[model samples]
Target: MNVYFLSGLGADKRVFSQLTLDDQFIIHHIEWIKPLKKELLSHYAGRLVAQIDTTQAFQLVGLSFGGIIASELSNIVHPEQIVIISSTPTGVPISKFYRGLVKFLLLSPFAAPLLKSTNSLTYKFFGADTPELKTLLKDILHDTDSKFLKWALIRMSSWERKTRAENLYHIHGSADRLISIKLVKPDVVIEGGGHLMVYAQAKQISAILNKKLKSEEY
Candidate 1:
């Protein structure tokens, strides 16, 4: 099976480096593109459809904001299945408080640098406890484009999708501070897993994927 992966907000393919799947799965990483000013999330997802090889059957795996993008893509392209890790299928789980925060950030001068800075707060929120995980998170944050980050934040905070695909499988962390488990009900929950559990708990996630993806059932 050909599986296309979408990384988190402003993250790259490195986020999925720890995941190991069976040889039968051919993995492809989808790169994020620049969003046009005031572009709708659905429109942005439609633009992304160009990258997918729709001629053949494929599955999707998304993380964080990427999962939201996957949900949008599912509306445009019919994939065999969708596995979202540390993410939600709909934006209903996002708190309205974030919308105000995004507006404030856009107006504040310190917002750009603050969003790019990887500090203890960022670490705590992301649950990057280990030194290696902290470093990786720091690098990812540093490399993220401020404009893109702001754009995604605005779109994500205001997203209003209320439905999900029938073939969608959600995997969430119990301790994820960013997207609290209390907000949404996931198909599978990883104990002690946090926002970065896809990296920290790769072994467990990989095992789950192996079983879930191989099964004939959704």
Candidate 2:
């Protein structure tokens, strides 16, 4: 069976470097493609669909922003199951204060710069704590295309989906700062785990993946 994985915003497959899945499943990491100017996320997902080998049984594992992309892909590829980590298909939550603040920032000339910046403040805020995690985050951010980053922000803010996915499973971090558990009801929660727990808490995540995905016959 083929199991495809997608990384978070401005990230790559390295996000899953620590993950260990069942040997019966072949893992393929879907790399991000450059977005067409002003492209809608659903349309972008359509383009991404071409990369999947959909002739056989497959599953999807997406983290953070990639979770949104995975949800969009489900409308087209119909995976066996899709797992979400630290992401909500419904939409990302923004506090009233941040909403008001972003409304103003969106109009400012520095909005793009803010999105492109990979500074310590932003990394810390995103919960990349350990030196290794911080280094990976910095590298991923540096490698990310500026245009794609800007477009992803727009997609995140404007994403809209109603009704839950029947085959979708969610695994969240109790300590996730980027997406709080208080706002989401996940199928599983990793206590003391942060947004970047995919690396920090890889053992627990692997245990869940192996258990949840192992029994399905391909």
Candidate 3:
């Protein structure tokens, strides 16, 4: 099976480097394109899906912001499986803080530049504890395209889509700072995991994926 992988907000494929997928699955990293002026989430996802080879049997694996995109993409073309890490499906209960942020703030039009400074506050927020992980986060942030980041951030903040796909499988963290676990009843939960658990708890996540996704015949 071929699995298309999407990264987090302002992040790239490096975030999934640690995942150990089943031998039968091949990984294809999806890239973010520049958002059209005031484009809707579904419209942007339609553009993104052009990169996928819809003719083949495939799955989708997305983390954080990427998960949001995956959810929308699922509507365009049905995938065999959609495994989302550290993310919530659209219409699921979102935290009060997030709701407030979205309701009060104007998103999409805002632009977030690639950050050069890897501040301690940023590390604490993302749960990057070790030096290597911090370096990894820093590099990802540095490479992120500002315009696309801003566009995604805004769209995420104001998202209102509420639909579920049958093949969607969500994996969340108990200690995730951004999205509260109380708000979501995920298929699998990583105890003491944080927003960055995709990298921090890759081993455990990989195990769960193998069991839930890979163990079965698609």
Residue-level lDDT of model 1, residues 1-218, one tens digit each, is 78899999999999988988998788899999999989999999999999899998889999999999999998899999999999988876546687787778775877889998988999999999999999999999999988889889888889888888769999999999999999889999999999999999999999999887873553
Candidate 3 weakest lDDT stretch, 10 residues: 107-116
The alpha-carbon deviation from the true structure for residue 24 of candidate 3, after best TM-score superposition, in angstroms, is: 0.5
Ranking by lDDT: 1, 2, 3
Query: Which digits, one per residue and each the tens of the lDDT, describe model 2 over residues 1-218?
Result: 78889999888888899987778889998989999977989899999988899998889999999999999998888998888988886775666677666556655677766776667777766788888888888787788876677678766776768755768999998888878788788988899888888888999999998877763543
User: Candidate 1: minimum summed lDDT over ten consecutive residues — where?
Assistant: 90-99
Error of 3 at 21 (Å): 1.7
Model 3 gets an lDDT of: 0.82
Better of 1 and 3 by lDDT: 1
Once fitted onto the true fold, the runs of candidate 1 whose alpha carbons sit more than 4 angstroms away are 93-98, 215-218
| Residue-by-residue lDDT tens digits, candidate 3, 1-218 | 78899999878888988889889777899998888999999999999988899998888988998888899998898889898988888755557688667534434343243233578877877888899789998998888777676667667777777776668999999888778888777888899998888888889988887776672567
TM-score of each: 0.95, 0.90, 0.88
Off by over 4 Å in 3: 92-117
lDDT of each: 0.90, 0.83, 0.82
Deviation in angstroms for 217 in model 2? 5.5
| TM-score: model 3 vs. ground truth | 0.88
